[model samples]
Target chain A: MRGLFKKRRLLMVVTALSMLVLAACGNSNNNSNPSASPSESSAAPATETASASASESAPIEKITLKALMHSSWLKGGMEAVLKDAVEKTGITLEIEKLPEGTDGDNLIKTRFATNDKPDLLFFYPAVKESDGLGKPEEQFVPQDDQPWMANFNKDVWIDAFASSGTFYAAPYGGSSMAVMIYNKKVFESLNLQIPTTMEEFWALSEAVSKAGKVPVYLSAKDAWTLQIPSLQSGAAQDNLQEITDNAYTNKGTMSDFTAKRQGITFLKDVVDKGYVNKDFLSDTYDNAQKALANGDAAMYPMATWVMTDISTKFPDQVNDIGSFLIPFNDTGKNMAGIFPPSAMYVVKGSKQEAAQKFVNYFESIETQNIYFGSEGGIPTIKGITNTQLTSAELDAQKLADEGKAGPVGVSPSSGIPQYVAGDYPAYLQDVVAGAKTPEQVQEAEQKELVKNAKAKDDPNFK
Target chain B: MLKRQYYRYSMLAPGFCIFLVFFVWPAVSNFFYAFTNLDATFKYTRLVGFDNFISIFEDSGSSIAFKNTFIFTVVTTISKVGLGFLLANFVNIKLRSTNFLRSALFFPVILSPIAVALAFTAIFHPSRGFLNVLLQSVHLDFLMQHWLTNRHIIMYSISFVETWKWTGLTVILFLAALQTIPKELTEAAKIDGATSWEQKRHIIFPLILPVVNTNIIISLIGGLKVFDIVYALTGGGPGNASNVINTMVYKSFSQGRNGEATAASLLLFVFILVLVSITNKYLNKDNRG
Candidate 1:
């Protein structure tokens, strides 16, 4: 009986080992097949023939590239537009729409880790920063430091993105930073003008509250949204990039001490004064968006994308939607900032020649126009213009032109460390809940910055 | 007889093989990965000597998550077990319409957690929610505080939802255990001139101790690994007030800190193992006594 039991245990162990090996093999198989798709593999033969003819001249071969991109990029049949462009150039294209969260990042990471990378990778700035070093500076570095980083204009950094030096992905769509979307009917009903100053904004919020409507519909449940007004406060607003840079590099004189205090104060005041729903923190982004659509709240701080999203989501109420930049310092400037150029990069170990050709084709003015026209993305190419933009888009452009716009100070994952983004939201939410003072929030933020700096500097620390 | 046993074992081999492949192997691999610096970016990783385990203690997020997880587990376990037992006893009494009452009690268990959480969110809404509206109707306006956002109250709010969802399962388990108790013991206690409460204390309670122990272990284990309901509801925030071990692991992994996330998972596994073992030993001893 003892011998029989021992034999059975050995069999169990063998079966377990075999299963693991099989599972690993199965994963590897799944990874490789998609890269070696029929169209892409077929293009390889024509490229080899072209290479043979130009042994002395190294001719650039016409090759197709497969790209994994975000669903946002594939809006309004943009993939089909790209497909048509690729066909015209004798280059085949295969694009896969990625799902949200770690699934997309993991898919890309898995491909790279397994040496089965795509020809062109559509890198989302959000996912890159999400998983990396917690600071914004470290988050901005492009994956593999691709060559296209050098071609982008540095001055656009003030309008769109944080870093002036590094470019990983090319910027596509430009969004207004920290704009408040108010119901036009509510403004008309209350006889209130669009408030441009901090004091006026608060007064307006108060009046809206007194009128028995939720003053601001903040989806505080997703902590990120709660920090928008606080992080964009007059003080933090004055030297947004500088503070972000300082926080990342652990250098530079911090500025806007009062502004940071005021920002936190405003957030706290809004919550304490009953301008926001008490259950705001428990609400989802979708719920908050729906609330705005249903006219449940007078205003919500969102990006320019909300205009397009609102128009698409609620066509009937789209006419009532209007936006103005959140008056963080009462500057009366309608433009907050521009996100850095979104672009594609070729992985390091990729078949470089084909990848480069694809990149050149993708960045061409014609391709840019197609992408812009299809997705309403602002093309990065110098001369490309989008003619079919909505009224909100036109207003946003005017704001950018008037020097009212600024770059995204910190992204969730990539441009700066998340501790900056992550901690600020909670502090603001506490202020809303009447738990913390604005001064306390600012002090706490500075302490967190110091803590993050210590952690980044210490290699021994996690 | 030996040949027949061998044939029966051979027939079970296919299922055993599948179990080994899907569950046993991955679990063993997860155990191994916990000891390495196996990040998402790197293909090859070196075996780091307890660095991940050491970090778990040092990180504030992990510590908070551990404490929150323990609190949630202990609170939910005791409430569900104790309340469920009382409920079960009441429902198990002779009744003309027992089946309908039992079904009504078990209804919450059948509802999807997301649906239940959404319903509760509506109920807990400060200005417009059902709970506050009811409070105001009854002239208790002072009690209406922000239920989901308040850090002090959020944990309990989450626990209430969990208890609401799971109390039914506990009740049913107890009811089943109650039915198995020999009627002779209860009758003997009654004949000895014991009161209803006394009879329950000595006879029914002692008889159901094993079942109570089993329910407590199950509920405690389930509570320790609670993820979906909390994830759908609080998402561990208004700050990190409601964050549990699984949510922390998710956030860490989402942030691309795979090594840290694995470490958190490993620590949670170790905690569950120790907790379940202690409970098992204590229960066995209690039953014997």
Candidate 2:
């Protein structure tokens, strides 16, 4: 009786194994088919096109492209936008968002370490070669070979990846302008106009304060939030080009953020005057949205990304928020500062052809117009304008039209520290907390940036 | 008999292979990477030997992390064990409420550490958080201070949260050990003119020494390797103020400097080993005697 039962179990196991093998084969066929379709279907272009359209717009083979990115990118209308993007690209997307900051970086590193890379990665643009690695191409494939390079805004796009003359990623939307998003209702309720200069802005803040509302929602709990006024000041520099050029060469100093420049000092002004949110140090990104939606804070300095979050959380106030560049200049001139975006990269040794095709489609003006607003940044494609502009984006567009906006980086070219606050966010936090004076913060930043340059074995390092 | 023995040896094979695959292999690989400049990209790696270790020491952040780790381990171990021992004595009494009290005390031990830390984050929020609100409500507004952001007290605030969660386990362990001590031994000590403290010192305490050793070693190891609480709560920040060794390791790892991260981790491993060894030896000196 036992032997008979064992025989039946063995038969069942064989059947399951056969089905598993069949399922595995089916999955491979699905992923590999898209790579072949573009070329194969091209030969039969007219007939294939007709057949594809007739077949309810479904591609001959369905494929899932694995994409990894920061968790924050998933918010706003990003899902609806990505769904439309994936439909357009003829491939489905399987997205995994890593935690923000260090956790995300570590998780990506582990994926790289195991050689279990995603096919498509939405990540910060950086390349580290310590002058020790023999050859860079052993790990990465450059976009110089990718066909879509011809369409990008050449000057801006080429430097989006590593500054090493080896481009490896696709540039989509990058910040060419940052704006201070405000509640229009609060402005109207308090009877105030958006100020155009730093002095007027402060005066406006004072007016907002007297009206019994938070003038500025400073979510200082997030260390990255401390970089805004400093980055704005970077944009205002007449010597911004010289500063960024020399920063990688170990010649950059904290004096780059001089008091006369009005970025960091502007933050200090707000802090000193108590124009910053009372619970600024404890309030988070989400809390700021609630505050803004409810008219608790009249103004917040953030990129366009906050628009979707506010709109989603408070659908009623979607049109109530307006945006404008922070007036950091003494003359109160409105100017916009651009920061880099976390871009999408085609992973080497994956379905490269399919990934690149999807990327090519995704970067087109039509696709990017939608993607950029979801990211709360401007499109990197030269002529692509975000069509679904929030009141804030329209304000940014006005600045862009005047040619008053320019791309700014903490270190734009050398990639020493990709983000403006890369090495000095903590020091900025120290300054904000009264633990360190601005001079002290500057000295510490100078020391750390130099250290970072050397650590990366940057060519410009002294 | 020989066939039965062969089957027994075969049964051990699966478990041994699991240990080899999961624990030994990764540990050995990590130790190897400690000597190499293997980054996240894995595009380039060179054996840099002691350079990685030297760099860790040279970085000022690592030193801060090391100091934070030591303070966290020492403070949490002493507090958890000491408080657990006292609470164990209180709850081990023959009373109905004590039975309920034991359950309530042990309840936190079952809750996730990350969940606890996250809750405490809101509790410790500077303005709108529960702690400050409660303080304001009671008109002790002067006592309201930044719990997680104040640089001076950030580590202690984290340590207190950690202690609050794990101290329950220690209490249970101590209570079990206390229960194992005979009522007769305590009664005899009391009849011989020993006070409650005297009875505990001479009778209950000596018998519970092994359990104390166990709790100290467990908590010391936990304290040394603490990661989730700090990661979820402060994230070693507002500028690395509450950074411990594990958080530092995570920072380096995220930066794709595998060698530096592994070197930091190896140092942490050695620190934990040394702590465990010292406590184990100190407590078992009586057994050796």
Go through the candidates in order and give each one's DockQ: 0.35, 0.35
Top-DockQ structure, candidate number:
2
Worst 10 residues of 1 chain B by lDDT: B37-46
Candidate 2 lDDT, A183-290, residue by residue in tens: 999999878887767678888899999988999888777767666666655665666656766655666665665622356666667788998887676778788888
lDDT of 2 at A333: 49
> What would the per-residue lDDT of candidate 2 be over residues B135-243, giving only the tens digit for each residue?
9999999998899888888889989998899999999999999898888998888789999889977888888888888998998899989999997898787776888
- Per residue, candidate 1 scores C-alpha lDDT tens digits across A48-100 of 64474467455434556677776655565256456765555446667777864
The residue-level lDDT of candidate 1 at A262 comes to 55
